[model samples]
Target: MGETNVKLASINPDAQKARDLLRIVIVGHVDHGKSTLVGRLFHDTGSLPDGKYESIKAMCERRGVPFEYAFLMDALQAERDQGITIDTSQIWFKTEARDYTIIDAPGHKEFLKNMITGAAQSDAALLIIDAAEGVREQSRRHGYLLHLMGVRQVAVAVNKMDLVGYEQEQFDLIEEEYRDYLRSIGVEPTFVIPVSAREGDNIANGSKSMPWYKGPTVVKALDSFLPNAPLVDQALRFPVQDVYKFDQRRIIAGRIESGRLKVGDTLMFSPSNKTAKVQTIESWSAREDFTPPSEAAAGQSVGITLDEQIFVERGELISHVEEAPIETEVFKARLFWLGHEPLTAGKSYKLKLGTFDTPVTVQKVDRIIDTSDLSNSESEQVERNQVAEVTIRSRRMLALDEFTSNGRTGRFVLVDKYDIAGGGIISMEGYADQRAMIMATKSTNITRVEHGVSIEERARRNGHKGGVLWFTGLSGAGKSTLAVALEKLLFEKGYNSYVLDGDNVRHGLNANLGFSPEDRAENIRRVGETAALFQRAGMLAITSFISPYRSDRDRARAAAGDGFHEIYVKADVETCKQRDPKGLYKKAIAGEIKEFTGISAPYEEPDSPNLVIDTAETPLEECLETLVNYVERNFRV
Candidate 1:
């Protein structure tokens, strides 16, 4: 991948002469004049090779077809015959200020993947729209793709103005409509200019036909877009590609994605929390006894030896000790699916991000977004060529970063079987970075004090073994009601039992925490630890809370070990809303409450539970009897 990125820069031979080279991708609806605009830009800027224009004109005459600037870019005979671009094409042109590599991507729906391939490497974008036909569905889809791919610098070209008679009203209407759509999706167009790509109006020079219009020409806009900031100034992201051995020295090699590294700098490997100082920076050289460089910056591929040997492998991210990436087992992603089969929930796929690879499952399908109309719909599966937001889960903790935080490490592709099925950008919106919590040590001088009483003695005195019965479900699902009733029954039957209701604990123990996802995880963590202690003291701890995230629930299970029992109180959202015990559902539906589970927030159901009580359908007496029997069979001394 690093070698491929190196080739992208050398495509433009004039790169050495210009101060900066900006890669721009052009996309639009089919027949929106994207090719014509690109060809015209090259011709008007005098960047076309000698005799390249006349040769195309003669070919057009021999075929008895009209001459079109688009023919210059549609070089493939098959593309000219079909009159639609089928693949991505690259061209080089220059303005007085800087050089440009214009990537002309296909505008057809069937070729959208090719378009994504071209746009993914671009620094900025140029979106073309037809003035006469207005903004079509494909035009809106292309705009959304640019936003998803993280291209912020964009310019809109209202092409084929000749067909619209160079009227300012038509251009204004189209501009207003498209500008509103782009803004809704968090994209702001830098410029909106009207141009006739075939006639070369407003492309390289001002248009006299449209006297009332005032905007920079296409060439001027290309020159005005600023180059991206130097990647060396950002946080370090060095993903290990391989570990090598040379003359009894173990060297780790990788390309620096961002920031810099020098000898003696302490580097931390994420997801493992291992740290080592850089002993030496190694590079390939032909001459013997060559002096190795002491430092390396972003875009350089170099090897290094650690001060001391430790277990290290490929796919671990290397960063400064204080600026490490996020270590998490799950994250939210916005991805585009291109697989033959629809992307469905609970399906497993291989996720490839940077040098890391892991088996990930689709935890849930959040929503499918219609790029054409910008409407969201809940669907069980994402069809081919559709964009969807979904939750992804890995089997274990993985090192990564949020796309918004670090694009290089956060972007990933999903491999279905052996085929590349989808691509996405990562967002840790509702998830926690568990590195600090996992590695944190509150006190170093303290030791765990062992209890004097034996477990068997405590069980004999309490008449039952101590354990945690964790009831999890949506609000108004009868979790608290069932838990309290069970607590009373267990106490009357000569067993020590207590109920830890969500609201009751929130009033005191969790008073400092809010309903945010992060706070909720922390709350669950505290409750799990407290419940484990209760069990150790020979008491049955029944806990009731709407634990929405699976990872948090898993943490609670880990805390209690074999003493945890997951009791799923199953009830659909409609049933829960209909049985609003505390009127919380009504408030949530009326917008008075935000981030309420089963309404504004998400609730991930337990994949496998020890007990599933269908409170929505079963009678209270029968449910209580079933719970009593299960406890008698398992927990009785």
Candidate 2:
């Protein structure tokens, strides 16, 4: 030690109450001395319980093994036996400046899940690197994981300096390499210092071994980190945990994850699109005569009563109407997978966000990321411990925020069967929020007029029932080809039918619409409404368009109701491009066309379609016969 060691202070109860507490997780490659560092910090600060150190030394003596600092932190029998940490261990620590909770996270590759659990709860991180080994692959992986988990404040400790003769050159090399790696992932390390944990050098005091080095000790670096500010300024994200009834009063109970709310504030619950005003903010206090709280903010578990009774359930997000979360069935995610089975596209899993739970399918595995090198590669499935960027689709709309906007409501976990298999943060780079669009109906004075002629009478006059044959797929998947043939055959069979091709409709009904997502949605809205009217008129409205989004098609289904039939025109992108019926695919691939489905843009496959026409393998005549038989069998009334 560089300075005279003062007598260690005992943990003062009075000081603990007034001081801010910070949770710091120590992580790195296995055998990088994370445990030894933790053990030394306790001994240097004199925070260990009386007789706990002596007992641990005695246990090592009885076992006929040399005493090591790592034994102090590896308290579990399994850990001591294996000489490796397998789970997370939380212990209290204190510096002269603040009270601290030290979370010792496992650094082994197989115990990555335990590491993630620890990191997710931490406010900052202390990453250890073995000087002799320098930056290993696991070190890079840990850095990426920390970034993925949103741990921004980081300090790097180049431990085992004694093994390398406390050389400044070696420490500097490791620091520079690892620093560049962290910065590549958008993490700027606050400090990087060389220390010997076992010798108690540069931990609580300055290091005498390295006279040329001048920096704050590990304790000083930790004390300098500030606590995260309260989330009062962010948008409201109150996820309903449960609903309770007492004396004919229904109270919505949940933890306010962000923002503040007062009585009389209007709240909009999402996925249901219902609204209510907060009548009372209920909180339990020790005093019996305590009146309800006038307001509540983030980190408070509260119950609120609404001014009106409405149907609400767990997992509904509550927000102010003006700044509500995005409601969409699909969104992009960057996730770290920990499942035993590979995460493949088209596979379904249960997603848990806040209290919201819904079944979601992996629509596309965009790319597999190599964390150690930060390289990307295309893969159909993401293996265990692999990170991937993927598109996830839920059958129903979910209310969520972008992780950058609000982390508490944007992060989620994936459950496979019964186990949590993966976790991720949400991003909406190219996708729309859809909250405003979904709730944009402004009609106030309109009436639906029932026709005098019954549906049965119309069906009898047309010689068949009516329907909207919705054809959806990629651009060159033979939708127009099959739809027109089906319409002609149905007409020859004495059934009233019409073909609404994409180009033909765009030239007239949707002439005003552009190719933007919002315009495309509006175009589909108009087409769905028109097709439904045609269905009501006892005619088969055959629609052919590259309706790529599942949500858009679902809206069309809702408009047409039971008379809607979704026909999937199936063809792989490569096959469709090879056919190049209209040369659109060539233009899309050549960058002449923007936002082209199956090329530059996305094409969502239907989860379940009424019928599938495989144009690549099936002949045109056979495909036509399948269509004709389906219409004749179902439409004949």
C-alpha local distance difference test of each model: 0.88, 0.88
lDDT by residue for model 2 over 66-175, one digit each (tens)?
Answer: 88888889999999999899999999989889999999999998999889888888889999999999999989988998998888999999999999999999998999
Residues 542-628 of candidate 1: C-alpha lDDT, one tens digit per residue: 999998888778888988888899999999999999999899999999999978999977788898999999998999999999999
Q: Give the TM-score of candidate 1.
A: 0.90
Candidate 1: segments with Cα more than 4 A from true spot = 1-18, 48-68, 71-83, 286-290, 445-447, 507-511, 578-594
Q: Lowest-lDDT window of 10 residues in candidate 2?
A: 1-10
RMSD, every candidate, angstroms: 3.6, 7.2
Candidate 1's C-alpha lDDT?
0.88
What TM-score would every model get versus the actual structure?
0.90, 0.83
**Pairs in clash, predicted candidate 1:** none
